[model samples]
Target: MTMSLPQQAPSPQHCLIGPLPQLFHGELAAYGAALAVADTSAPVGTALEAFLDGPQLAAALALFALRFPGAHPKALASTWSKLYFNALLVPVLAASSACGWCFPLAPGRVRFLADTDGAPLRFVLEDAGAAHPALDSAARLQPLVRNHLTLVVDALATQYRLAPRLLWNNAAVIAEETLLQCQLLMGAQPRIAADLHFLCATAQWPDQLANPLHQPTRLVANVRQRQLCCLRYRLRLDFCADCPLDCRQRQAAQRKLA
Candidate 1:
């Protein structure tokens, strides 16, 4: 959704990337203690506010930026959440499916970050190579993947009391953003070896989503329409790359003289 995102200089001396497990090779306990204070019982806004009391939020934001380096956050809570969810669900699910597990995600259980400014700067699922509880059977993989992804998104939406369509819209955006990236990755020479290619794999779609919510909640639903406008154009002079044009929907009073 960010156009012309400002490039933050990567601190080669500080950034790190690797199998999340190896990255936190021996530090899970300390990491858990740091996030223990987040107020999960409060209202959405209150919870997010309390959860951010320490450096946890900043660290999480840093993790969110790992996929697309130098990505900056917007003031909108939705924006922050969308980025965070993309970081958590997209890559994590793809990574899990790449292997044979259904690694559950949470603010705590899944790998979070202390910092990402060091050597080896791409965060990946080192655990993906291993198998876990799920059957990974063709009939079950879609629900497995969908439920895992929906679990995190649902919890976040409920925790933050976000709007009804927030998670759905976010899911839409993630699908589009991911497929676009994969298309580029597909064109790489010698074939880039990556686990994140599932986003664009047709074999991954038909069963990716568990329910047929929305007009069509298939893995990459409505790819034909591309993207629904972020609706920002309704209030300002800006439109996102996939924002659907609806100039006709504008009030006659606000019509321009073009």
Candidate 2:
């Protein structure tokens, strides 16, 4: 069984916490994400590379299958990526813009925490110490995409027989949404706002490869729409309100009800 984590504890000395406690309070806390300190109370958990390897990925897929009965492998993969990005990106990007800190997300330094069912819960990672110096959007984002997310996306795509674009879309949507929220909250700080804007608006990283995150959504008519469907409806969930595949009429109706 997954033991309940101890009541909220003080962040470890080297964990990323610059302005996080204040930024994540009150109603905004619902959107907050953080890295858990590595401690005995939490299980040692699987290393990030283990997900790319055979055993841990298989176990995680089995648990996801059990968790979302009738989900196709595609939907299952999407679900996993959504959770993964939420746990990692929301906090990391927020800290980067809000406090000028960047996390060292190398696979070796990061671990994934899961419940008894092997469902991912959070990550345990250490801060990389000082922040990078005035990096452009491409340089600032390169390590995050290439060093960390790309490996995970490649693994999931190969394992699930899903397209890499779909997985990238999953991450892109989360990143786009996170940056938008950060802008709303940190708009008063020009650098923070600019960082958020450059991260969102730039199409390619330093490598000049087509950025999957580059405008993953668009303003369709008046309503915004996702560039690609996440395929979750295959699992029997409703099409995301912004899904491009869903007709504009249905989207309008849903918005009215909201």
Candidate 3:
């Protein structure tokens, strides 16, 4: 008699932001290398522009906008601008990071919302909910908004093991700051902006440090199958060089020994 073995379930696959990251990393590296070789007196704006226009960064921003449909394009663009200024420009100009390779810094706000059917929807509370009557259009969109927000928070938690409090704090701070800035510059009222700001501000990164959901780490989907499932991302600072030399060098030595 022949015995049969039980079949195992197929594991779901994930796709990380691939080509974009590679492109950005390569471009930035090249620019940095060129700067290193050139006279220190060379203009800095050229290198800065190169980094900003790098294929990877542009692709990443586009991907981000597509991934979170609930976010407004203008708002997304603004967030990217802030991120570039804060994470890249600030660090590089300040000469903070080791290779001067500033990681992409995304402000902590900018989220997503989905309809009841799981389709993505854009939601922004401009002027404390007064300027945009659409935000309060109906109660029907609440669940979608909540679910989208939850998915994004959960995803981040899974990826970074970020503390809930820290995530919430960061989100609130960034959202409020961004919204307030928008209100002033665009003459936006308080209600919608404030409300929207509050929602994003209060959103906490889901607690997934203990048990994470089974999802692809690099969440890749075909063009047709892609759903705006992710919302908000922070540029991961690659501080390997700036990191304390003790542990890093020790680990290197250990690897050589092994």
After superposition on all C-alphas, the RMSD of every candidate to the true structure, in Å, is 10.7, 5.7, 22.4
Best by lDDT: 2
Off by over 4 Å in 3: 1-145, 188-190, 193-258
Error of 1 at 200 (Å): 8.8
TM-score of 1: 0.45
Q: After best superposition, candidate 1 residue 134: deviation in angstroms?
A: 13
lDDT of 1 by residue, 1-258 (tens): 212111343233222222323221232212111111112343111223234444555455555545434332331334554445454444333334333434333323333332343111122222333345354333323453455446545644554465535555656556445434534633542211222233323334554452312321222444333233333433334444454454565443146412
Better of 2 and 3 by TM-score: 2
lDDT of every model, 2 decimals: 0.37, 0.67, 0.29
Clashing pairs in 2: none
Report clashes for each candidate as comma-separated counts: 11, 0, 21
TM-score of each: 0.45, 0.81, 0.26
Which ten-residue region of model 3 has the weakest summed lDDT? 1-10
User: How far out, in Å, is residue 111 in model 1?
Assistant: 5.5
The better-scoring model by lDDT among 1 and 3 is 1
RMSD after Cα superposition, model 2: 5.7
For residues 1-258, could you state the per-residue lDDT of candidate 3 as single tens digits?
000111222112111121212222322332111111112343222222232334533444566565456554433443333332222221121121111122122222222222222222211111111112334312222332243334434433444454433333333333333334435544655443544433443333233121111111122232111111111221221212212224565456446434
The alpha-carbon deviation from the true structure for residue 126 of candidate 3, after best TM-score superposition, in angstroms, is 23
Best by TM-score: 2
